[model samples]
Target: MAKSNILARTGNEAMAEAMRQVNPDVVAAYPITPATEIVQIFASFVADGLVDTEFVPVESEHSAMSACIGAASAGGRVMTGTSSQGLALMAEMLYIAAGLRLPIVLSDVNRALSSPINIHCDHSDTMMVRDSGWIQIFSENAQEAYDNMVQAVKIAEAVKLPVVVTTDGFIISHGMERIEILDDAEVKKFIGDYKPEHYLLNFEKPITVGALDLTDYYFEHKRQEIEAMKASTPVIIAVGSEFGKKTGRSYGLFEKYKMEDAEAVMIAMGSTAGTAKVKIDELRAKGLKAGLLKPRVFRPFPKEEIADALKGAKAVAVMDRSDSMNAQEGPLCLEVKAALYDKAANKPVLNYVYGLGGREIKPEDIGTVFDDLFEASKGKEKPGVSYLGVRE
Candidate 1:
């Protein structure tokens, strides 16, 4: 095992520390609420000569991502940070980066999108880009955020896909926690060196990139991208396993908490999972077989694995921090239901859209979800979308 240090740091601080350890070649970012501190701290590292990163402070988030794309195309290990509107501004460039197969790692501090202009914890930002072809990882706390940031670089470079590591804005991003940080040397050794198979900087075998492809090869290229995502599942598992061996902190697509003999389960992502775990323990102590499944990786869906994990559960409750506004279930709930279709045909699955605009979700509130799940299992409560913690 590697020698590690326990430090009290916020999620943003942990992520910035991880970036300083990784020491990427280029970082182009725009400051945004909650997420600003990540790149802000990284920039200080660059200024103080702590790392040899070329920090580009752009005028807008779109320009920041554009610069990252340019730097990455030139075969540089690149990264950046953004949240909410910043992510929304970079939407166009995000697709381009993924389509071109640039391995740029991004840190996304999850915050609600603007309408009423709230700057707080929510999944609306990341959920908006769920299908943008980037691998998404959600951190439960500062420790996971730091761990995930290190792993994301390896994962992105291995699969040649952009990755987004998200921490709940203010909840994890601002909340301080004790994080076990690996030695800088260990992180460098684990991530290894970036040696791209092909890049624009290669003079001997120069190739065209971003050429307009209307119909001839667009579909085929898209198919290749699809296959890459499918291929990434095993790579994710392998990397997680290796990270575990190095530091004894293993990770997977989702975490199953007390699911051994669970009759009622709550599936969630990000910081809500932390809250759900407490309620699960309380329910278990009350002699109820309640459990929690927290998804760390949201992209690639992990449908089969998720289905397998929820196989024994009689009732399942999915908590979504962002609503899809489809008048049905939230994004996470919709996907969870789809995953359970064939395997748990008769299982009752409920959808609870909670914590929008950073509304507080407490352990007692989670207890209510389990209570509803138990009732659903008994065929008393009908499963549907419930606005949890919302005044209805």
Candidate 2:
């Protein structure tokens, strides 16, 4: 019930607006397709003096993340944006950022990685860095993109880890939608201020960063990082709950749509979940118990919670926009299967890799997934990976 501004904004514009409101101390970014406008619009804010920020126009995404690391080490709240190749180039620095425990926030427009030179919506880029140790949050549309960006700041700072907020390229990035934006004052009040316990700026507490850790103590540091990630789930949930109380939109690890009493369930992320919801409704109208499970947080995967949600379903299908290419299941599917291995092992779980390279996934396509789930439940179809919307 917070005071808000109703506006039609593309996902890129919404992310940029959220950045303007947060007004981090530093933003070193390189422009890339779909994600370019996020930093592009923020740059204009810098030029117009709307926010007091040091906008560094870096030569490449690698340098952008490098610069962000330096700024963050100096106790400055930092953020940036990138896409497919941009994210790939920044991959090396990404590991360093998270290992060093820098609270840097990144906006990643989810685009397919290139080998054949494609620029379109897909989760490949984000999934590529799944183990890089950053908290990953996916947005379903423009509104979630905006809200996630705002909440990401708090999550990163609270956990002292880097965070990546992603939106499917062009799908959500270019699509405009009516969004309820919270007032700037509310956003400002909600985030509060950044106060680092140890930073380069603190002369009295000077400490070495990015120091080479050899076999002597590297293991302990890595273990601590692992524990931190394990501990971040609560931080993520708490911040999401607080943001909801302030903005009237609550978020969680994932969304379970019509899961109660559902015999067939399809799990997905990003904009695909929106389409799946429609299909679930239609199936319900036809007297089919279909449902959808949409994961908002990919990293620090909510294994137990996901297992619990799918426990009641007779059949579950996990839809992934990117394939693992390991001749097994897609990334999201693999996670879902692993989650159900012990808890819901008896249930039939299917994997569907769809919409790669921005191929459209219609409501009918979602219905097809549900159909497969039902068929698998009845032991008519084996549970495994199936490429959807592809010429097999």
Candidate 3:
């Protein structure tokens, strides 16, 4: 493995460093709270000649994505960053970017969607675009955020699909932590050059993009996208393996912590997994067979693998940072329930919604969850859909 430099930086700054190393052809972005710093830092890199990237400052997030789509289609490597409302604003272009099979890397700072207008860490933004056909990877901390951003370029280009690398808004994005960064030469070699098979700039071969296909061809095109999304699983694993070899940091679809012989388990994603790990350790010392499963990739869902992991547990709880507003459970819970639905093991699955609008999730809150899971395991009581760390 190559020697890495350790630096103390926020998740947003780490992602910007990865961007500078990748040094794409174009970066089109608008400022949004939490996520604004990522592109802002990258823009400075462009200005200082640290990176040879064309930074396009657009008026709106929609325009930012639109410009990215245009640049990407023209055979340029493209990237951008945005948060909650900004992501919602770019929803339309998100589909377009994926439909066009443009390999644009997006850094999404996960924040709660607003009705009351607040800024903080949550999964509402990324969850809203779950089915937009983009490959999504959630980071547990600043290091993972940086690593994922670098790997996203390879994954996106390989699959001819856009990739969303998400970090918790204020939690990971604004919080500084010590992270190991790959050398610039190593990153450049790892990402390689973005050479498209077909691009608008290739005048030698004329091709049209985003042509209107009403019914006859639209379905087939979408099917191709589905296949590509499915095919991304192996590609993700391959890229992760290569990255691990270089950096000695291995990544999988999901990480299982102390799940072996565990009777009770909790599933979650992003930075909350860090807290959950701490809680799991505390519970383990108390002789409680508690464990945690953190899903790194959310888009492909990893149904079979997740089902296999939870099959042995007597009771399971899924933590969702965003409320689905479905009158029942959140998005992560729904996916977990669906994944385990066919499993013959009669594990009782529970849902807990927490950390919305920058709400703090303490270790005691997580301990309470394990207590409830232990109770549910003993068949004493059933903990159904519940809220964690919320004022009732």
Candidate 4:
């Protein structure tokens, strides 16, 4: 393993540190709560000459992304950071960026969407863009957040698509944790130099991008985009494997904690997975066959791997931190159910929407979900949607 520098830092700071190490050609960003520190710190790097990057302070998140798209189209390594409303404002540009196949890296600090006007940790922001063709990776803590940020650049460049490295807003963003960072030279060597095959600025091969494909070509273009998205799966795995080899930390599509022969399991993403791990340990010590499955990669869904992992579990509970507002189960739950639809096991699965607007989801709360899963396994109750840590 490569020698690493151990440091204590918040998720945003960690992400910014990784950005500094990568030293992209351009960074365009706007400040928002929780996610502000990431770009703010990076801007300081730009000003101090720590990195030779052009920092563009845009008026809004839309302009920030638009600038990044332009920079990326012109054959530059570009990145940015945003959260909640910032991401919502850049919704249209997100699809455009992905469709154009620009390898832009975005650090998305997860926060709840408005209406009640709350700014705290939740998966709503990312859930809204789940289908926008960006490779989404959820980090459980600062270490993972930092590691994912570095890996994202490599993954995006390899797939010629955008990548979103997400962490819970105030939960992981502001919370300090001990993390290991790769040496600056090592990171640069690993990321290598980005050389695009086709770009707007390539004088030898001039090409028009984002052209309006009205009828016959639009569908084919969309199909090509889907193929690119699917192609990202192997690239993600390859990058993650290479990262693990350099560092001692290995990552996969999802993490299975003590899932071997587990009769009851809990599936979740983001910071809550950390809490679930604690609950799983507690239940395991008490001789309960409990486990936790935390998905690091949300896009491309990892359907087959997830199905195979949960095959032996008699019951499963999918914990979603954001509600879809469809009056039904949340995004993660729906995907999990669909993945297991034709499986022979046909195990019972439940959905619990919790931790919205930064509500505390404690270890005890997770234990309760596992208890419910065990009960459902015994046919004591049918699997369904419910709320945790919420007032009815």
Candidate 5:
């Protein structure tokens, strides 16, 4: 398989390719930093007829998401994006997009949620909406950002769920990287076409959507949503394999690195995890048993796979990109603890909250965090949820 130069582009540009490849019927969004490039490139495609899609210029991010909800409910393959406060603005409608099963794919260029405001990246933006019933796929680089967007559309449309192709805001979104974007004929053949299970705009078989489900059935519908999420785990893997076969780009929900004999491991999701792997390699060279567990599918949580992956570890460290305010544990950390709590002979889990508010997370900083976690494992002192790249 020859890897051709598919144009070296930023994360935002790659996302445009995704929107183009998915060929959504409607692309609705307002510009926000980090995520704005997605719609910018996509809008150009609409104007040039590169994509046969409706481009809606809205007043605000809220309207952008609302438009998506409306378009998706109307059975259109809808795409949109937002970052930081922009995503927060779209919070309410996001849940509506999912409960109503609209299958919209939005790029959430991960930026810090503000108050002492900043324009950088963090998971707080996405973690704030964790329970909104969206399947979140975090990308390690521009390539994953692009590839995942294509897969996200397929996966979201398949499970009748909304998907967010997330990456660190300025980190991955702004940084330039060389990536091989998959061609249309290849992606089209593999991803197939978008066919809605319950389209609101189908004139031939018009039916009620978003009808208020009474207490009697609301819980049941939500329960079904839970089942649908569980179903996505296998479906994403199967579909991802199919994508790899088509484009020579294979992927997993959680990227496992050197875990075969790892005694003490680290787990993280999204862009920072990529840097963590570099640190793990350095530790391995020093004869330390360090490894990384980078979760690709964040929403479903991938419990079974995660438990099995960390099976042999003596200590596990979870690196969280976002911090939950006043919560006893971070969302991902809480979930990891829950996953291993039931098992016997399990190792202690450590969590370090790093890279908040778009703070720079250098490869060595990641290494230092792991060294602290590893020190805790060896009784070198410091342990438990240390916040990295933060000034005391």
Candidate 6:
């Protein structure tokens, strides 16, 4: 029941310390910017016996995830970290781990997907793997990053599904902030030892893993994974509540700020939502009704909650950090619309795209955005998506 204080650290370091406190049996990874430090810190802990963890020095990201799949199949409490192309390299293995119901806990420091080779923050890296059957949760800060890493393990282990704790690349990964870290004993007790129902290394069981599935059972195997993902929603909220009781920090699938009696709202994800929240506060202080609905759980999208949150508003602005490249709508916006479809008299939705390739988004800009949308709601203007702080 003791709380510990640590000096301000980049979110990556806090995540590493949290992983160690959770005490995974195996920690295997190769260095990649933003996320490499997480594994390095744990590797040191393993080397110094600070943690009873096995260190696997894999040559590439592909092998990093492969190592996780192997350890997880054997029922070892396993963890790993990666970013951008590293995640893409481990892309194929992601589904493999999930398909086997490995219950692996991974952290993806969100980065821009490559082609022109962007190394900054965005959702493309993690978004690309959204359909890989992993329960994904996006964190807004270092504390949430640390907390979610621990909770991710609990969620994954509970549902027998793989889970990912994601945060913006440079936003949290590189920025330093003082964080209250949970004690190791509590982590051990909270996460508990991962007890697999079917461990591959169990000689008594001798169960087959990753076996070739014919059409007869292929759908069944995949269906179970999907079912596991759906089951994770309740588990995610439960674990988050436990952490809140322990640390006094509460988070939800979708969190709204200043939405009450507001005529307009901005729904977004990642760190920008926090920025928007602050601006919303300032606007509300000036007597403007502006609210923000920040989606913490990106996968298995929180449809019912979102619809209810934006129900009475005249307008809702959905901000996405990454574009669909050429899609009709940004990923989050399109999903929000679908989440609201079939509802009666919903608000007009505006889809805005920003922060691609690490474009800076300031809070004052959000205020201007609200002014624009508020006017549009009055029939004196029009609502449409525009890049905030993007060069023409």
> What tens-digit string does per-residue lDDT give for candidate 3 at 1-392?
98799999999999999999999999999999999999999989999999988899999999999999999999999999999999999999999999999999999999989987988988999999999999999999999999999999999999999999999998999999999999999999999988999999999998999999998899999999999999999999999999999999988898999999888899999999999999999889988899999999999889889999987899999999998888998999989888888776567888999999989998899988888899999997765899887887
lDDT of 6 at 301: 78
Candidate 1, residues 266-311: lDDT per residue as tens digits? 9999999998888887788889999989999999789999999998
Candidate 6 or 1, higher TM-score: 1
Cα displacement (Å) at residue 282, model 6:
1.1
lDDT of each: 0.93, 0.93, 0.94, 0.94, 0.84, 0.85
lDDT of 4: 0.94
Q: How many residue pairs clash in each candidate?
A: 0, 0, 0, 0, 0, 0
Candidate 1 clashes between residue pairs 3 or more apart in a chain or in different chains: none
Model 5, which residues run further than 4 Å from truth?
1-5, 379-381
Clashes of 2: 0
lDDT of 2: 0.93
Q: Which scores higher on lDDT, 2 or 4?
A: 4
- Prediction 5 TM-score vs. true: 0.96
Can you write out model 4's per-residue Cα lDDT over 1-392, one digit (the tens) per residue? 89999999999999999999999999999999989999999999999999999999999999999999999999999999999999999999999999998999999999999977899999999999999989999999999999999999999999888999999998999999999999999999999999999988899999998888999799898899899988888888888899999998888898999999899999999999999888888898999999989999998789888988998999999999899999999999999998899565587899999999999999999988988998999988755998999987
lDDT of 5 at 64: 92
lDDT of 6: 0.85
Model 6 / residue 3 / CA error / Å: 3.5
Worst 10 residues of 3 by lDDT: 339-348
Off by over 4 Å in 4: none
For each candidate in turn, the TM-score is 0.99, 0.98, 0.99, 0.99, 0.96, 0.96
Model 3 lDDT, full chain set? 0.94
After superposition, which runs of candidate 6 have C-alpha atoms over 4 Å from their true positions?
1-6, 380-383
lDDT of 6 by residue, 1-392 (tens): 34766668788988998888888888879888778888988888888888888889999999999999999888799999999899999999998998888888898998888787888898888888888888888888888899889888888889988888998898999899988887788888888877788888899988888888998999988888788878778888898888788778776787778878888899878788889988988888998888888899987678888888888788888888888877567888888898888576556778888888787889977887788779867865454667777878
